[model samples]
Target: MDENNNLTEPNDSQRNFILAIYILFALSVVFTSVTSAVGAILAYRKRDDVRGTIYETHIAYLLRTFIIALIGIILGIILSAIGFGLIIIVLVEIWYLFRVVVGIVKFAKKQPVTPTGYFM
Candidate 1:
């Protein structure tokens, strides 16, 4: 709350930053891991700035997604010896894409998102 006792929401830049992170995650699923890593780093670095604001949840969400995807990628690589790893990798990629879509849609609608979940 501000001096007027009104709620102080995140500003436009913060909002745009969230959207940008979503974009980076979405792109990373198909094109490159670099963007995802970059997005995760941004989220990690900005986590404090978003506390008590809407972006805080988004940063948490992004971090969770990044970690889950990393784990899935590793597991997929380990299982690749049996060929099941291919399936695991594809599933992880699909799951990651689905999550990115859901997150971005909810974010665009300005919905309140939970920080923890595979789905929005």
Candidate 2:
């Protein structure tokens, strides 16, 4: 409550950021890798602004997801030369999609992500 005893609502910027992240993730699933990179960059840029807030966990979750997906895809490509990379690539893609969908669902429900581990 402010001096007027009115309840102060949360700012819209946080919600905007969350929605942007979800859109970017969905784009990544439908389009190319560029969207994922953009999302990761946005998360990094906004990390400080959300620090010490609940949104910070979401930011961290996104960063970890992006980095892990990138690394896994690269490794999958390299290992494909050995005939085993095909499996790795498929698994990595599935994992990435699962994380994005789960995150979006949780965010939409206004629920805090439990565990918040490196993985989904």
Candidate 3:
């Protein structure tokens, strides 16, 4: 409502949402596959806010990575069972790192960057 407020950075809620999503992304590799789904659900439920949208995008990216890893793991298991699927897992890990770096940059600068694609 005031000029000061208008010029201020994103409020607490927005920051929290982005932080939570970042946490989830960082933990995705360490946690079980189901964790991605849980994060996605949280993002969707809180979709009314800017933070929520960022989380939603984060969730989508995690979900995609999870699915890709799952497939790679399964294929590796079936094909060789010698750990060939670790490649996919490694790729996802790199992607997570990239996302986090970009996220931090955007958040720190107070830029309105959407984690999700055009649909969000």
Candidate 4:
């Protein structure tokens, strides 16, 4: 809830949409950016809908996660020229999976996650 007393728990439609976004991010592991890209876009589209609710943090969290992952991937590619970029890329994927799983758990419990902080 916010200063206006909005519902903290997500409604049915919002719940489904939020979970779907998380799932999309998770699927990025196999799709390799395609799914996460779609998820990020969807999250941005939904950002205003949850404005004053706890779900707003969820959207920001997802966006932050996407940005960090993208950065890590780019850095990995750049460093790959030195033969160690694969390690950073792999770690970023694992981190992305971990964050998504944590986000899903938080969503299930109606818990608020860090919206701007890195590493969840």
Candidate 5:
């Protein structure tokens, strides 16, 4: 019984580390560059841990999202010449946001987030 209780209680550092990851994820959307950079650093530093894999996945997601956004921008510019720019941009942003949110949630929960529905 005592052993069980001890097992359930995380030490201070572990608790703080878990909270830090959550906070970093929460701030990622608003301050992506900084938050993601910090996440990447932490991920590299803790490469042997399970949490490190999550952070690494997150970093990959961030980079891919930016690449997708760039593609959207270029497409938007080309489409604007044909008068469908606004619609395409809106759709792309929505898609990008969805991928980021879903991927992060799945990572946090230790589930596999498959690339699907235009995510490549």
Candidate 6:
């Protein structure tokens, strides 16, 4: 019984981490840069815990999404000085929404995100 409980604890913690990722992603849509950064940090901190498990893919997906989004935002800001960043920022926002929605859907269905080697 004690062994069974020990096994379940890790599963529960993993599930909580997954849930936290989803919530942070959702919050990022509303709070923008702040929550997105927080989400990325959370994923980074929890990465080791999920290694070799299904959630590892999620961490990778989220980490990549966060990095790309940050880059896009920075580029957008820089280009805005030249009047091109508005479009880039808008596109990046859409991409963020799409990634979050897809991630949530896959998570809901309890399926692993297929490794695409790039942002999906």
lDDT of 3 at 45: 67
Per-residue lDDT tens digits for candidate 3, residues 1-120, read: 212234334567767875675566557667764665565556566655643333334445444544555565566556555666566556645655565566556656654444343221
Worst 10 residues of 3 by lDDT: 1-10
Clashing pairs in 6: none
TM per candidate comes to 0.89, 0.85, 0.54, 0.89, 0.50, 0.85
Model 6 misplacement above 4 A = 1-10, 115-119
Task: Name the best candidate (by lDDT).
Answer: 4
State model 5's lDDT. 0.54
Q: What's the number of clashes in each of the models?
A: 0, 0, 0, 0, 0, 0
What's the C-alpha lDDT at position 35 in model 5?
66
Ranking by lDDT: 4, 1, 6, 2, 5, 3
Per-candidate local distance difference test: 0.82, 0.76, 0.53, 0.86, 0.54, 0.78
- After TM-score superposition, what is the CA distance of residue 107 in candidate 2 from its true location, in Å? 0.7
RMSD versus native structure for model 1: 3.6
TM-score, prediction 2:
0.85
Segments in model 4 whose C-alpha atoms lie over 4 Å from true places:
1-9
Q: Give the range of the ten consecutive residues with the poorest summed lDDT in model 4.
A: 1-10
List, residue by residue over 17-53, the lDDT tens digit for candidate 4. 8889998998888776899999999999989987767
**Candidate 1: tens digits of C-alpha lDDT, residues 1-120:** 112223248788889888889889988977998999999999899888777676677788889888998999999999999989999999989888877787787788765466676776
lDDT of 5 by residue, 21-111 (tens): 5456456556664564464456456533433333334444544555666688679878998899988877876776676667656655644
Candidate 2: segments with Cα more than 4 A from true spot: 1-10, 114-119
